[model samples]
Target: MTLLVGVDIGNSTTEACLAECGPDGPRYLGGALTSTSGVKGTADNVPGVVKVVQEALSAAGRDQHELAAVLVNEATPVISGLAMETITETVITESTMIGHNPDTPAGAGLGTGTTVAFAELGACAPGERVICVAGAGVDFEDAAAGIAAARDRGVEVTGAVVQADDANLIVNRLPTPIPVVDEVTLVEKVPLGMPAAVEVAEPGRTVRTLSNSYGIATLFDLDPDQTRLVAPVARALVGNRSAVVVRTPSGDVADRRIPAGTLTLIGEHARLPVGVDAGAEEIMATLRRVTPLADATGEAGTHVGGMLATVRDAMAETLSDTGGEQDAAIQDVLAVDTFVPQRVTGALAGEFALENAVALAAMVRTSRAPMEALAGQLRSALDVDVHVGGVEADMAVLGALTTPGTRRPLAVLDLGGGSTDAALATGDGEVHSVHLAGAGDLVTKLIDSELGLDNRDVAEDIKKNPLAKAESFFHVRMEDGTARFFDEPLPAEAFARVVVLGEGGMRPVPTRHPLEKVRRVRRSAKHKVFVVNALRALERVAPGGNLREIGFVVVLGGSALDFEIPDMIAEAVAAAGVVCGTGNVRGSEGPRNAVATGLVDEHAGRTR
Candidate 1:
């Protein structure tokens, strides 16, 4: 019997699978997965590679020396970048809107009054309701004290908008509780003496009055035409716990459409020009018009230009680091149009309006120098014969063939973190593959932007784990239409709201979005990346871009292991009258460690 280890370094994860081979071929032993230390094919990945190998060895109850050989995948590293352009611009000359999610807003209910500076609040006439403005220069203590003194003098300070991260701090010290919205970055720009509305909801609730256009219209006594102009302001404040909107007569907010800019796709025959505003379908249609892209450039001084430049520079630097002085030119770029719900500048209600953006990942084909360097490092550390495996797609197809009921003339979609790779194998054993960007990381960015989570880690958790809403103390309703009962009561934060299934435990999501809404966003993001990429990849390998021409499709790599993704993709692929399912590596390991398992199987003959 021969014991061997296979390692596959992905953009986000590092995996190792162990197998024992004899005359009967190969038998599955064990596998382990961990976060990749850094970019794949780089020396920084060695530590994570060693960790996963050691874990698989421990699981198999085998000594490191007992392993005959170690094979690491020849990873095609990709560099991903994100760029945002605000599609909707509101230019309210005098009225400033503040709409953002501050973790700790204070008190509840709406307060409408004239805007007044904190220092001048005492000088205001009695009985006139005033909304105090506190700039960043004012501490929470002084702001609270000033408001209290003004109130004692019979001046009604109905509400307050502050610049510091002290909304809860000032509210707790107030003589009588009033709504306090804090963390306004442009507090100094807030127009004093203008009519304003401040609304703060109770804990775990979102402000309603400010989120509705009709509500703002009634409060401000605006005409229909004027109310229509304020609709964007209301939309931006939809999910915030607290908000403040000031009315400036000259303030006319217009939703100015920013040109996302044009992209120049250089092809062998001709160059195609597409605008970012044209959407993904149009951008991709333009790409299809040009079979093989030589290089892509964005118009200078535009968002797309900045975005493309960023990706190229990053890939060039990474390649230079690995290959030493070699000019790293980006061979190809994949662009996906996505949106980001970004907070508006000088917004009074902390509002976040949806902004148009592009997500891109650039690929630079590299030589075997990096792989050789990694092999040298591993040999010095593990004291084993390290070999760089065959092409990643070829090994994956070979491993995918181990799945029950799968055979030649099939296609495999290696949906990984950085890229979606598809390979087609003819009945006689010839394979053709294409690697493109926009995969798991792109989905994570979409989730983060749409939900306005502002935290990539949380967005990733939301993407990978099943979502549920805590309905009662004893049970939580899961996204799969099932309820999980707990023997002990859940934490208060997890009650009556959506929560993400985190490694530590059930963690509550702060947004006011319902469970179904969050689930919809998550699924939509997956569709945008995986489903779209699957068809795009297969079309390149099939004749006339007809998916029906392909017989079967087996999904490999880490993403195929997602709970709902495989079934979703399978259903979609079946529409083309083609059979599709997640690969079961070696008939035991399901949809994971394909490249790693394939490495061992492909190396078996050499060992013999």
Candidate 2:
């Protein structure tokens, strides 16, 4: 019995497939997968590759000496990350605009009054209509009773701002109804003795008065110049259910802008300059026009320019160290249109506004020096004949062919962590492939920015799993609006939240967004990354650059295992009459162990 091991080094995982090869043919034995130790194609990946091989050998109940040969895939290395530079920002010069949502705000009308702290309400002389500010130390019950007492003493309490989540609690106890804005973490900082406007709309409605610039001007009797300056403040608060605007001294705060800088696309005799503010569509369109990109650069003394230069320099340095003859050059860049939620600088309440921005990932065409070095290292360590196999894309296509019901004139979408790769295998043994930046990691970055999770792991969890809302101790509402009951009560932390259903069970999501909102964001992110990339990739590899020419597609890689991604892409490309589904590599390995199995298959032919 001759045993052969095939190892595949992927961007996110390293897999090993063990098989028994004889005169009859090769039979699949077992497989094991582990997280890749480092960047693919690098020597740093040797340890992880070895561990997976050992695991496969153990699973198959075989010893090291029983292996006849070792085969490894020629892995392509890709570097990916998220970068942002806001070209133009809308800034509120004065401390104004509270655009956040509290679970339950109170009242229905807008109220304008002088700002006064809760403690000072008792000392009011008379008839001073005020918006009471309740800070951390003030109890909601006490604040409500104090407002009623002050109203009885002829001091009209028109509205209230609170630092805690007790807006409904306080409003239910009030004698005369008043607009209330709660969950203002900086309530103590509200400018006292200043004119302020508070607006709380009815349930299922957003504030109209505070969210409009003209309405704000009408209430404050502002001059034309002042109204124009406050326009951004109102625009920032457009979608809030409740809002507060307090007038502070002018010039207290100024908007900040990071020069987005110019992108210099160096092509054959054509150098075009594009701005980061031009948006992703324009940038990609410019790239499409200037094909065969020689090199791209950013303007000097700008955020994007510096970032591009740094990446290029790092790649060049790394390549030089690997004994490469040519300097590393950036071949392409992928840009995604996204927004980052930024907090207002001087606002008394915690307020955030979405800033239009773009995130980018660059791709570099590399040599085989790294993979060659890694193969040499593996050969010495494993004490066997180990060779770097065929081209990465060709191996992927061959492995994809092992899937049942797939044949020639086929397309394969390999959606890995760092890159999305596509290949087409023709009937004449011809293959074509293309690699693009921005894959799973890019989706995580979008979720992190849009939701303000500030944690990549948490964002990744939201991206990879389904969501459910813990409506009660024993009941949870699923994303599909169906309720489920649990025999035991849920943990306190999971109650009243949209939780992610991860491998560890129900974990609470740390955002105030409802289940539907978070679900929409998650699916939208996937659509933007996976579904869009699937079509884009298919177009590139299809005959005559037309998707309709491609007959079938097999998705492979870690992302292919995602519960919804495969189905989503399949449904999306169904219009093109393409049969798309996750690959069952070797008719048994599922979506994984494809490249590994292909490595052995390629080796068996050589032996014959």
Question: Tens digits of per-residue lDDT for model 1 on 538-568?
Answer: 9888766789878989998778978777878
Off by over 4 Å in 1: 32-35, 54-58, 61-66, 77-84, 96-249, 326-332, 606-608
The residue ranges of model 2 lying beyond 4 angstroms of the native Cα positions read 87-90, 116-129, 134-157, 162-175, 249-258, 309-326, 482-484
Whole-model Cα lDDT of every candidate shown, in order: 0.82, 0.82
Q: lDDT of candidate 1? A: 0.82
Alpha carbon lDDT at 281, candidate 1: 77
What is the TM-score (0 to 1) of candidate 1? 0.78
Query: Which pairs of residues collide in candidate 2?
Result: none
